[model samples]
Target: MEEWTVKVNHCAVKKEKPQTDQLEFGRIFTDHMFVMDYSEPLGWHDARIVPYQPLTIDPSAMIFHYGQSVFEGLKAYQTPEGTIQLFRPEKNLQRLNRSNDRLCIPAIDEAFILEALKQLIYLDKEWIPSAEGTSLYIRPFIISTEPYIGVAPSHQYKFVIILSPVGAYYKEGINPVKIAVENHYVRAVKGGTGEAKTGGNYASSLKAQETCSQKGFAQVLWLDGVEKKYIEEVGSMNVFFKINGKVYTPMLNGSILEGVTRNSVIQLLKHWNIPVIEEKLSMEKLYQAYLDGELEEAFGTGTAAVISPIGQLSWEDKDLMINNGTTGELAKSLYTTLTNIQYGKEADPFHWVEKVSEAYAVK
Candidate 1:
């Protein structure tokens, strides 16, 4: 693929800044954006950076009607050396194409997209937050833009990448969050679009998320769509389990999001000789492990919250508490290892972090 034509158009004003001390996730955005269009005749053209503004789409856009859209979430960290770098962005690009393949959306060449993103982020380097517990959040998405309602794949599509300067996910600092084990509603089904990071999957979970919020939980612990006995994942994140002296996560069974963080933790655990297994983990066995003192801890891993320890898992009138109602030792180990590599504090044995150099936004 040839280099994507890059143009810098800056936003006029910053959206009301969130208190850097109270940075909430996904709330504050930068001043510039990168967008490209694709049509059956002209694939991926008009790649440009424009002012961060509300998008205008036709009422009959495919995204609004037949639900053809996919997205990715990752972050740009301000390294200790003061350079902005992305954490394993190639993995994200790979997953984006997986989603594209699932949704019948044409693939944007990964290297081409990465260069465009680097060029765009270089232009918005100033937007990369430097304060402790703050960094630039990157959201890249694609929508079927053909103005029609027939429900077939759209002839036109739009791909956009936007950056948001965000503070830490928790204003109170990195603390353990309570999660509820959902028994009734399933997040994704077997042989479905469960693994794809499409907007519809997220939209289907809003009600469940609301229920979790109402019940005073941070997120919902989803199980297999059919069996409903085994573990799956959390909202847009993958789940990890620490049982007895071993670490376990549900194997990638074509129904769960394969998180980059999850893979990183598994690699680091192996590096330390910590026995880690990826297999089907049943909720029945999970609760039994807790009762037998075999289940020591649990947590969810993703780009948004990093490795968030699950302090409590409540379900079916059964409440299982994880180690003193606070952060687990395993959680701390994984978090430190992952973030250390991310911020360049430790050697990246997996070569995951990708550094961004030179700016592209037309300043």
Candidate 2:
């Protein structure tokens, strides 16, 4: 592993930490963050741990114009024994590299970055919240920093990791939420940046999300960008449907994000001997399942929500009430099992959690 410099924030007055109960998603940040620079000749270098502060970027940076950036989200949970651990963090880093490949950005050393992240988390270990439904949110991102206006990949870039103590992604927590099916605005098309964890895919969805929010929907369920028939994702999470004791999620068709939680959910289902299928699921078919009373459950899975039940899905101005507008038994079980594994409350049969040792921090 590479040796990175560490600069502790020894300011006279430290920033006040928010109460775990009052913590909002991605709002309150820790005292320190991890940063690394990348240039054409030097590659990724100047890795350091410094105090949390804003970056001084050039006004003409490529990221500001061409939108060449990629990011990954994960969480660090504090166990009951006061040990900090991460849930499938390596998967997130691997996905980040996949996103980098799509964005024409230089690949990062995932092992080294994970080590640097562990060191950063260990340095700010106090920020890890122990409250139920709360964990330290980790945002690892890379941005093009070369100050150029040409429509091409930048030569300079910055990779940063910041931590935030968050309660729940949605204000409803694990409760069911109403979703509006997006028919007008398309999130991404096949052979686009949908599969990659990039910002442009999200930025394009905000307008539709905002439109649905005003209609009292928590989020918008995006359909396929080309034919607009098959389901792609729900808001920032991958969605799944349960019909007649079988689980189904949209297959990765180059337009859907392969979520870590989604994969875990499928694995857990298979572990329990439940039939789970990933295929092209259309809204009409799902509605028919609901009409036939076979739609047992619906939910969205992501690092933030873990498992968010879909109480109602509005499509074509008609509402499809799922599970009587309540959380399903399977959804609840998945949430409990995943959260327990993350917090070390249950035995991790899959060995997904990685503990962060104090030795990672630089003295």
Clash totals for all candidate models:
6, 0
TM-score for predicted model 2 compared with the true structure: 0.97
Q: How accurate locally is residue 34 in candidate 1, as Cα lDDT from 0 to 100?
A: 86
TM-score of each: 0.95, 0.97
| Candidate 2 collision pairs | none
Highest lDDT: which candidate?
2
Error of 1 at 362 (Å): 5.8
| lDDT, candidate 1, 268-330, per-residue tens | 889999999999999998998999988888889999888888888897899889886788888
Tens-place lDDT per residue, model 2, 38-155, is 9979998888888889999999999999999999999999989999999999999999999999999999998988888998999888888887778999999999999999999999
Candidate 2 lDDT score at position 133: 74
Using TM-score as the measure, the top candidate is 2
